[model samples]
Target chain A: MAATYELIYWPGAPGRGEHIRLALEEAGASYSDTARLDAQKCADIVWAQMSDNNLGDKNTSPPYAPPILKDGDLLISQTPNILMYLGQRLGLVPSTPEENDIYKINALVLTALDGLSNEVHDCHHPIAKELYYEEQKTEALRRSKEFIKTRLPKFLAYFEKVLKGEASGNGPWLYGGTFTYADLVLFQICLFQPQTDSQNLASSVYRKRDGVREKS
Target chain B: MAATYELIYWPGAPGRGEHIRLALEEAGASYSDTARLDAQKCADIVWAQMSDNNLGDKNTSPPYAPPILKDGDLLISQTPNILMYLGQRLGLVPSTPEENDIYKINALVLTALDGLSNEVHDCHHPIAKELYYEEQKTEALRRSKEFIKTRLPKFLAYFEKVLKGEASGNGPWLYGGTFTYADLVLFQICLFQPQTDSQNLASSVYRKRDGVREKS
Candidate 1:
């Protein structure tokens, strides 16, 4: 019997947890999105897991934040780490592990997360993650402007390079002509992108990617 | 005779590249720190590799930034991914390949980098990573204060939990009492921390962890 996975993350719009959820859905794996459950029934699950009472945590792997997963007794956290674990198990990555193509796929995953996901996150909360967006609006606006102008395009151009390469086989995929978990990661990241920048396909940096014109 | 690994990163005080360098040094592996060379002799190395000519990079893996490495024909980027590769080859990770402890180790590495290394980078550049510190001094100062008050202690307290746990073997080591690449990563991050907090280990979060007094 396949073990049912339980995913723990904040209940809200798709964040990093969306990357893991997309991989699981693509693989048709059994899983539970724990934080999405009814608030009355599962309110403490998040606080319990990220419990501030670190003094009592004797467990081998207590996660620092959410987007954590449990597979039987084993617990894992970190968006890329969780995706890598599921990638190896659910046929989302290349089967030939000995060749080390997995690490290459993982490099692509880290880039998308750092360049797109995390950067956009920081733009919204430039001063402090603990404080709300209202508390940091002035700094957030400046950071967001810089992100749209500089950082976003740098990453989009890099993805354009990957999309154009022979390794990606000339269309949508990010690596080696396969629909690896990296493709899922890129797909998830595109959802949160500033719509205005990403939509103007002909004028945007993504114009250089080969299949964009044909698809449009 | 062993093949010497080639590392490509900027010439400056230890940054993310130090994580990889420390791992290589600890494993006693042969490698070259490309940017550490004399100015004219290797001035173009960093620019050439992170070159803006994205369309021409048809290789299987073109790195987005430096601390990239060329291991024969393979080029791996991303700090944690590079560490994982070296950890596997140089015995910096646990030897068991099938058990998946490597991911557990990687989760620790990511937590330290995100919570410490990347946070500090943001403290210096809250508005724009490309802009000088003087251009963003007001915002940077505000962010740094929040970092000292909230983010740093949150991560340190988490590490304190890890150190107190049996998984860390009741001491300084991060996982299984074995010195893996993650240890090297933590050591590098500690260099950039605000000095006063970490030094007064007695009154700070480190007090909760078991072994600091014995060692100091």
Candidate 2:
């Protein structure tokens, strides 16, 4: 699809980029997912962007990894950072300089990325980011058990609590009465398939989302 | 130290909180470090805040972890989120809503926190955050080796390039000709001991900082 915003990411299970795509889709903003390219080509483009020679110029700082978002003269990286930029521009968040809600929403988003995404990622990778899952399976299994026992429920309960907050109103939203990128982020990552065996916890949160539309 | 801001974090080797301390010090913002309290009281307070009963209210979302910063009625957690909040209120970053520098600066700060802080942190606690360092010593050593070999040099090279960017203006600052929180952040985390064996890479970057004052 043609888009005014070009998202440069590996066209695979790029969950970090998927978080951005969720925000973009909700905003109905234009952005190509690079889905037209073959797998190898998508990987190549991701590597090429990280090449030192093409590292950003004076105004632009080079992005260390993928899921980069380019908007005209401005190029941004880092998932939360891109989300913040998009959140401000796309009405996924309020833009007024005096509002403190932007930071609150970003805080919840960062917590999700760390607990739900990064921690879960390390459970599989355990020892190394470059190593394959098979190489770390033993450690991965052990880590996964711990994750299910603690981290997963901890974060989900935290989000569940947020939805129950007085500001969250009747149900389902992560912040205030309106939907923001933080809500979209929780749905896209932690809620979808919900890497958990505690069906009770997952089902309870799922019911809350009945108040809001959710997409896989 | 009486200050307008109150930082609630465990008073120990709270390196994450130290990141905030660096920015506050550089900006000269007043915030008590909670050093006056005994260690037992310190640990109790940290756990108490995380208790679900105190998670947050209508306007506030409870923080999942510490290094939380409170500015009057506003409460923020997550290192980068806190940094972004402080960056705007203090002069660590440009406050103008129209300027993109805020995001650019934030992007760099997040990258540093991930690569330098989070990744390095995982090297020690590869299996679980709650696992003792001694328990994970073997994996920690293995992870540390990989970090020293690849991640360390890669991130430092990335920062060195940032310092070399034309906008960096032939000096040590991470962005533009100014010494914002980004520079202080680099100094506080990566440069303090710079968990790397590449003396040549480390020294080259250290020499550039001769143009700027560095603290331990």
C-alpha positional error of residue B19 in candidate 1 after TM-score superposition, expressed in Å: 0.8
Model 1, B64-133: lDDT tens digits are 8877877987888899999988988999765654386788889989999999899989899999898999
B56-144, model 2: which lDDT tens digit per residue? 77688778888988888888888888988888788876444438888888888888888888898888888787778898787789789
TM-score of chain A of each: 0.85, 0.89
The per-prediction tally of clashing pairs is 0, 1
Clashing pairs in 1: none
> Which of the numbered candidates is closest to the native, going by highest TM-score?
2
- Which ranges of candidate 2 are over 4 A from the true structure? A94-98, A194-199, A202-204, A208-216, B94-98, B194-197, B202-204, B208-216
Q: What lDDT does the true structure give each of the candidates?
A: 0.76, 0.77
lDDT for A210 in candidate 2 is: 45
My TM-score estimates for the predictions, one after another, are 0.89, 0.92
Interface RMSD (Å), each candidate? Answer: 2.5, 1.5
lDDT of 2 at B163: 70
